[model samples]
Target: MAEKNLLEAFLKAEELEIQGKEFYLDASEKAHIPSVKDLFKQLAEAEEFHRIKIREIYQTFQAKKNIPAYVTKISQKQISPVFDPKEIEKVASVVTDLAALEEALRLEEKSIQYYQSLSDKSKDLKVKRFLLALIQEEWGHYLSIFDTMEFLRDPSSWYTFKEHWGLEGV
Candidate 1:
């Protein structure tokens, strides 16, 4: 049935959120740099929020019930890894900080694409709106990661604009 399909879609999205959270949490734990560690923790928190939201949506539609009043909660949980910790560790060990940030950026971009496709497929107004909101949220995640990536790639260039140095390359 179409409703079953929608539920499955949400469940898949929820799985991605969990995986993302787990990846970021592990990355934060492994990172030595203070700023990178903090960024990863923040990203993990956002992914957990998305996981809860997607689960709420799945429950609402699965039971043919209305959307519940939502509240944001920040809690840590142990989720099964979708990506191996060793793999992330390898990247951390071998790659630059920009590479790790790029990985997060890629994940956010992929999530946005998935949400956009889901929104386009949805015929119901509520389903469409829900997916649209998710897309917007994912965009915000992408932008944050991108900004961090830019800063990490070139600290002087990134801060020069705000510092009003009027230098092309700082």
Candidate 2:
């Protein structure tokens, strides 16, 4: 396998993920709507998981090569997620569940893009594949949030097993 310079992008991905998690956590605490707060909290944890996955990739590189470049003093600070404090305060009060859902979707999209960039930069095919998987997973997360938002506001779309089985209206 060719040596990859994907270390930079991967590190950035981790930094951004951490930043996103912090945003979500902050929003969760400030949001007045219970459902929205819970949703934000869920997203915060999700971002943390994504960050862990990226860290695992770095560790894998270290374990496999036992090298120095992978073991660096450099932190993933370049692509770190940064939310404007004023914006957070403003949005926290006015954001509905739908709005928060949309923001979460955007954040997940950012993660997907970062992962895709990192994956493309990876020289090792295994790392590339792992990153691709992460990208797909992030897309799924974005979609799931959209679908959940849909379900939350539209209970008519939700069908219980009994209803689907024609056991309802009894």
Cα lDDT tens digits, model 2, 72-124, are 21233122122222333343345365676678778888888877877676676
Off by over 4 Å in 2: 1-4, 62-95, 158-170
TM for candidate 2 is: 0.64
Model 2: weakest 10-residue lDDT segment is 73-82
Clash number for model 2? Answer: 0
Best by lDDT: 1
Residue 28 CA displacement from its true place in model 2, Å: 1.8
State the lDDT at 60 in candidate 2: 64
**Which sections of candidate 1 miss by over 4 Å?**
68-94, 167-170
Listed in order, each prediction's TM-score against the native is 0.78, 0.64
What value of lDDT does candidate 2 attain over all alpha carbons? Answer: 0.63
Clash totals for all candidate models: 0, 0
lDDT (Cα, 0-100) at 44 in candidate 1: 90
Please provide, for model 1 over 1-170, each residue's C-alpha lDDT reduced to its tens digit, 9 standing for 90 to 100: 28888899899899888988887888787765566677788889888888987888898887899765432322334221122223333333424556677887888888888888888888877777777877777777677667665555555665664456784665
User: Residue 83 lDDT in model 1?
Assistant: 24
